[model samples]
Target: MSSTLLAKPQMRGLLGKRLRFHIFGAFAVSLGVVALYKFGVAEPRKRAYADYYKNFDATKEYEAMKQAGVFHCVRPRE
Candidate 1:
C-alpha cells in the first residue's frame, strides 16, 4: 500500500486530551478578569461617587437651582 494510503487519523491531543485543564484555566482567567474589574474600575468609581456625595447638601443644591430659575413653571389649569 502507498504510504499516503496508510496514514493514521489525527488525534485531538490539544483539547481532547485535557479538557478539564482547559476548562479550569478558562474559569480562572474569567475570575481574574472579574477581580481586576471589581478592583481597578468598579472600586475606584464607587469610591469617587462616595467622596462626591460625602459632603453633599441637598438644600444648598436646591437653592442654587432655584436661583437659576429652575422653579419658574407655568401654573396648572384650574
Candidate 2:
C-alpha cells in the first residue's frame, strides 16, 4: 500500500491564512467586549446616579438623623 496527499506548500499557506484570520477575529472580539462595557454598562449606571441625585431630597432625612443621633458606629481598628 502507498500513502498519498502528503503536507504541501499549498496546505501550509492555507494553515497560515487560517491562523491569521483566527488571531484577527480574537482581537476584534476583545475590543468589542471592552467597548460594550465602557458604553453599555457604565453609561447607564452613571446616568442613573445623575438622575437620582438630581431629584433627591436629603434635608428631611438629615434632620431626622440629627434629632435621633443614633448614629451607626464604626469600631476602631486594633
Instruction: List residue ranges in candidate 2 displaced over 4 A.
Output: 1-19, 66-78
TM-score of each: 0.66, 0.54
lDDT per residue as tens, model 1, 31-77:
99999999999999999999999999998987788777788773323
- Candidate models: Cα lDDT each: 0.85, 0.81
Q: Which TM-score value belongs to model 1?
A: 0.66
- For candidate 2, what is the lDDT? 0.81
Give the worst 10-residue stretch by lDDT in candidate 2.
69-78
Segments of candidate 1 deviating more than 4 angstroms: 1-16, 74-78
